[model samples]
Target: MKNILLACSAGMSTSLLVSKMKEAAEEKGMEVNIWAVSQDKAPSEMEKADVLLIGPQMRFMKAKFSKTAEEVGIPLDVIDPVAYGRVDGEAVLNKALELMGE
Candidate 1:
């Protein structure tokens, strides 16, 4: 299963998005492990993920997260505000897969 992790300022906001992404993956018959975490907890859990996604609120930290992702050997991307605002899980999931070169 692909492990996709979403990081947000507090982790609460992304919980809903995680649900949406999970649903989307299920619809496409994709087996994926998706979860959300507060930015503070990300680095510690980074190694467990196949891909990392940062929420818009924490967009400014992309540079930092990018470096960490590289060190951990995972693709990291910021979720598109438009897709995120609408909770478009499929779009985000596709982006993660694309970043993973799948």
Candidate 2:
């Protein structure tokens, strides 16, 4: 199972997207553990994640977290603003899968 971690300002904004992503994953028969955490909690959570997706609003934190993600050997990227604004879970999930070279 792939562990997908999303980091935002408060961890609340991504909850809906998380649900949608879960739905998309289920439809695709993919087994994944996805969760969101506040930026402050992300570093601790990264170790358990297979990939890290940062919320558009928290894009600045990417630089800060890149090193840790690199050390963990996971892909890290900012969510597409358009997809994020529309809460397009499938697109985001595809992006994550693409990043993982799936």
Number of the top candidate by lDDT? 2
Predicted model with the maximum TM-score: 2
The runs of at least 3 residues in candidate 1 whose Cα sits more than 4 Å from the true structure, single-residue gaps closed, are: none
For candidate 1, the lDDT comes to 0.92
- For candidate 2, the C-alpha RMSD (Å) to the true structure equals 0.6
- Total backbone collisions for each predicted model: 0, 0
Q: By summed lDDT, which 10 consecutive residues of candidate 1 come out lowest?
A: 61-70
Please, what is the whole-model Cα lDDT of each candidate in the order they appear? 0.92, 0.95
Model 1 Cα lDDT, one tens digit per residue, 1-102: 999999999999999889999999999999999999999999878899999999998999899888889999998988999999999988999998998898
Give TM-scores for every candidate, taking all chains together and pairing residue i with residue i: 0.96, 0.98
lDDT of 2 by residue, 1-102 (tens): 999999999999999999999999999999999999999999999999999999999988999999999998899999999999999999999999999899
RMSD each, Å: 0.7, 0.6
Q: How many pairs of residues in model 1 come into backbone collision? A: 0
